[model samples]
Target: MTSARIALVTGANQGLGRGLVEGLAARLGPDDLVLLTGRNAERVAGAVAHVAADPATRSRVAGRVLDVTDADAVARLAAELHDQYGGVDFVVSNASAMLTPDRSQSAQADDFIDVANGGALAVLRSFAPVLRAGGRLLVVASSLGTLGHLDPRLQPLFDGASLDEVEKAVESWRTALHTGTAEELGWPRWINVPSKVAQVAAVRAVAAERRDTDLPADRLIACVCPGLIDTALSRPWFTDFSGAQTPAQAATAVLDLLLTERVDPATYGELVRFGRVLDWHDGTPPQLPDGLLVN
Candidate 1:
């Protein structure tokens, strides 16, 4: 068994995910390993090469092909991790999809629900058993996904909803979208918003479940917004955004949560922005739409 710590990041072929893998490699001990994953084998290799190009991080980096939406692929990867590393110390669930503006509404909703929300759930469910106790699970989310943007009538339910309730609420939104009644039910037209909202809620629910089941009492699971980063996902709409941080800067905020030894109850299942925790249940207005990049 290896004594070095292990960290895995998904969708790391480009953008913030790539930056995150680089950042992790730079910070981890030489004996540590940072696994970068993506759906495309070639792209994953390219990212691995880029990160390994640095002499300081070269020996600490590797890559794998993984599509979060594919259950079999995720399960296979989990089994591989179990066999090789026993388990991982950190999992950055950075894989997500944002539909292009030209996509049809139904297509957009499908990508949001299936790729962003459902895919994240699949990753967490498949990897929960492989996440070492006291390890951190960081779900990269968006500030726009805050509960404040959700329907007022549904606020109370989300404020304290259990895992099952959150699942049902997400399903309800899916049904509404398919039935052409999402707007009537107060779901927003921005497809990514509802998906991320559910994603963040699910993170909280998962943390609560872990605590209630007495599993990994020290496990840290939370969602965070990386702030506006100049990435391919955001360049379309945020080319002139003055407050946008570089991908390297955004990666620091994520690493802060992943590498911290101290755990705070307030941070569990919370949406952290710019390294500060946000009150998910509070109805305060969310900060400006910083960028669209999920990471």
Candidate 2:
């Protein structure tokens, strides 16, 4: 009875989120449950039905409405899961702001707020305490979020502190972005790069706090980048798909990390892409191997 492994995924209605839920459904034991969540209940239900329609996965999938930006809503969900499932064994923080082709340029600054959530980091603040003892949480973050993306001069802002400090830094960047000084201030040309740095920063801070807690056992948390995938979320941004993988392909790799069930001390507070734990380089870009040849 206690052998049932419980897992949950945020933003499971589309794109990579749906892929992850499908991957979990296939990997987990017959009795295990994978809760597929989305901000919209109707969309979530539809996604679950589509993914779980297969007789093999139908029994393994469930749906719940979750808005990661809403703190109280997340708290309620956490409490409910605690009582109902005895706590969740796996959590994938995959909710991120989706940019549309018709989005107004004037509204871009406002979108920064969503970007600032750092997807996984912001949601984890509410969900971390509720994770089952010895459970794992994976943040669908990016390597672009590593400290190396920040200019060395501004990297100090993220040095050894709470997610609050990181949040504050993001607000500063947002203000600069609104004021048209972000470029002068050394924020990257790509919005995702700086925002991702915030995600990794939050993950690092929270992971350190978890290490000091009196929790039952290892509660592992880390940021994971699923690589460039051919999806609506990314297709508009990239001109090339030659190097990209499918959502299912990325999900398979991420699931391997989630189901590993134990943490590598080195990967404890890192941003992982595929299976590689990125090297932060202390705010310096990683140096390429000398004289490397490529065909």
Candidate 3:
């Protein structure tokens, strides 16, 4: 019998993360392993129960309490994954947070600090050692990060901004709004650049670094936007009019990409939407018509 294949997903208790777990379990066989994790122990347990209750998924389910913001915990989890499973086939970074709802009214830097920089980066670094060749790392990113989607005046946000920079900017924006100094009254609905760029860079780095490793094929890493998915993380403005997909539908697309078997280096760091790959600049995958879902 073949050993079980292992996949780890952060923030898997709900939303897209939850959907990805379900989709993968539906498609993959009994010998596959899926680890559902989140910051809340109860949510993690509930997610595990949800998967285990499924007759199809019961045999392959596992659970972990992982808050991606904890750097030491991430490193420890890496060690545990390596020791227990030998290696992992996939690592999905789905955790996220906001410094404040009103991007121009609050000064809470904790949100960006935890979500963009520490959380996403922790996901990458923690699993680097355990992500074997041929594995895939998919970061649930946003189209807002695309340099093109941003107003030309906002280019600086995407150009040289790091995760820390994002935190600072959000904090600045929040303060401005609170102080009634900004013209805008809403949160700056932009993608976090550090998280997005890190996903792409991490994949490339892993592939290049492991080019000569005894592994069979290079790992695939990608940043994807599931469009205006109906999730708690999204703004009401998005759900109000944007084309939105259910978490289940979005998960299906993500799983399809992860289980494709063919790992394309070009797909690394690119945005996958509507089951198609797109260039980051244009926000649409290649070979599709204009005004498609990606754009």
RMSD of each: 3.5, 5.6, 6.8
Compose the digit string of candidate 1's lDDT tens values, residues 9-78. 9878888898889888988888888999988999999889988997757438888888888877888888
Output the better candidate (2/3) by TM-score. 2
List ranges where model 1 is wrong by over 4 Å: 212-217, 283-295
Q: How close to the true structure is residue 46 of candidate 2, measured as C-alpha lDDT? A: 96
TM-score of 3: 0.75
What is the C-alpha RMSD, rounded to one decimal, of candidate 1?
A: 3.5
| Residue lDDT tens for model 2, 1-295 | 2558888998889888898999889878889889999889899989988887865573389899887777778778888877877778889988877654344322454554563374455567767887777788888887677787678877888767588898888889877777777768887645656677778888888887887551347667888989899988787566789999888888988988887766666667778877789876444443323232211
Off by over 4 Å in 2: 1-3, 100-106, 115-119, 212-216, 282-295
* Model 3, span 1-295: residue lDDT tens: 2267788888888888888888777777777888888889998899888877876564377788987878899889888878887878888888876422344212434465466546666776678667776788877776544545444454464444454454455456545545654335332333243335434434434445544552346666667677767777664334263567889977877887788778665675466665566654553211322221210
| Candidate 2, residue 230: lDDT | 94
Q: Is candidate 1 or candidate 3 better by lDDT?
A: 1
Please, what is the TM-score per model?
0.89, 0.87, 0.75
